[model samples]
Target: MNTNKTELNDQELSRYSRQILMPEIDYAGQLTLAQSHAVIFGLGGLGSPASLYLAAAGIGKLTLVDFDEVDDSNLQRQIVHREANIGQAKVASAKSNLAQLNRHIEIETIARHMDEKEVNELVRQADVVLDCTDNFASRFALNRACYAEKKPLISGAAIRWEGQLSTYDFRNEDSPCYQCLYPEDNGQELTCSQNGVLSPVVGMVGSMQAIEVVKALLKLPTLTGKLMIIDAYSMMIRTLNLKKDPGCKHCAR
Candidate 1:
């Protein structure tokens, strides 16, 4: 018998038996997930569901970063935070929710803004980075950090009834990064606060972010060179091929 074969303890086997039953995951892939680390850069709408599913899927370690407290406004789409959690650190509330779903994993929370150096270190340590953040400044900074660290980044955004998702794998030199898809200095950005979001739009996008994170960890085919755009009102989903910009300042060789 191969000693390196993925062996599940009685507890884990019972906990993840459904995942193990899937042909794509089975035992080996579940073990791969068990040893992987994911870093999420927000605990809001997108990060809420992303963190929850990632924890439930048994990622070995999850590092959650957010600098905000739960607001009554967040309760609309940020499902991880409850009315009782308002005024609490979003990361703490998220951790509490995630732990309830899966207590077998390690959850680390950072409830402050991270500078470039901090982001770089965290991205380097992570197998994948989920950019569920809302603002362009944070998104571009995270893009730079992930590119510098050569980590795959799962980027998601939702505002109103529209949402978008993409993955940038820095390991692939030809892949376009988040900056390539949009200008870093995008002006007058629309926010969920400024423009009302349908409650389920963010949840839909966030759930896909989790799916992309899992596939990235499992080495499965992902949206590495494509972008997905969703119009929830019309129920239309479209995937567009993304080309690396030769003049892209971020990922261009």
Candidate 2:
């Protein structure tokens, strides 16, 4: 009998004791979370908090995907990049920050945007996917990749004082993929840069997105079948059940 288990050492136990004490996410659940691999797109606003918590929680391997460089304006929300690292690529800066937080995890970073072919390759290896990009193009691109690979996705978007979160795995057969809810990608529109977003609003929503990623990996019950809407100003949270749009161009096939 192969009774081998990937057990955590005393130091790891000490680090994660609080999470293990929870009945739902006991030692076993914690172990599952630690061994999982997840990919996060755009290490900016949402990616900053999501990746930080994911790494701190002991996710086995994390791939930080981004191509931007640090800027003075980013300090308010892009917590992973330091002012000293301003001239550096976002991926390098973000990876170094994760290392400081938890050396136990592995970090792979790509400093360029990928298309359908390359995106699928990454998705196939990831246990789950996150869309933290600030643009509609990247979000839709990632959505196609996640749906094609059938990996659970935890996506987030925040602007002004509001944020929205949603998951798409369709493992249950009726949940909406990101495209099912957002079918068309109108080229001309408001972007994060143009409209602006509150720093903490991004932080709060990104952290919640990380929570969803943890839940998805552990096979725990989650808000996978719904979308979470948050109004940071009012501190209000609303969850709306999602249905697969039969005419959804991306997933109908």
Candidate 3:
């Protein structure tokens, strides 16, 4: 329950004036929000919105990790970067966008690829980690890091009008990890380029992912032990209660 409310001065107050007006996240919660740090993996379709929202919400430190470069194709869903940023490194572009949105918050960009060691370091440093990568390998990698470090994770994925989310490890001792939901190691999964996703789907899931991160940091009553599945086509959302899989290999490790 140790939180800070005086961290925001008159200038910071004026900047986060809108959010500070909210009862749930008033001056105190907004101060807590400003003192928190969230590290996001993947600067693609999902990561763009997640990072931007967290940064705008006064997250003290926002770290963006991705080695990919921006491309014309990414604009359809990656809202953090514009047409002019197409040729730049994705992490750099994302940082630029967030910095433009809020200068008071700090931005950290990792232009290098994330290996296991790097991920572990990030997990150790971050209050909440976000898994927004497009592939299972990266998701699993991040999951392992968060699990090992006992850090919370806000995971999200979207493909072809379908989006999914689940909160893991943030004091929910029995919540399922990402691998539990997807353990098959399927050879094929939908990708933005191949499966064709509506641009908003990514933002929708990404924003939700940001919400989960904020909740995790604030210990708010959000998706701590459930999966939120969203079907854009049907405009339907379902909550799937989850439990720890003792037989699961990753979290047990």
Question: Pick by lDDT: which candidate is best?
Answer: 1
What tens-digit string does per-residue lDDT give for candidate 2 at 122-144? Answer: 98988889899887788888888
1 versus 2: better TM-score goes to: 1
Q: Name the weakest run of 10 consecutive residues (lDDT summed) in model 1.
A: 1-10
Report the Cα RMSD per candidate: 2.6, 2.4, 2.1
- What does the lDDT read for residue 160 in candidate 2? 92
Candidate 3 C-alpha lDDT tens digits along 103-137: 88888889987679978987898888999998878
Ranking by lDDT: 1, 2, 3
Better of 2 and 3 by TM-score: 2
Provide the TM-score for each candidate, comma-separated.
0.95, 0.95, 0.93
Tens digits of lDDT, candidate 1, 211-231: 998898888999999999999
Q: What is the Cα root-mean-square deviation between model 3 and the actual structure?
A: 2.1
Regions more than 4 Å wrong, model 1: 1-7
Top model number, TM-score: 1
- TM-score of decoy 2: 0.95
Candidate 2 collision pairs: none
Candidate 3 accuracy as lDDT: 0.85
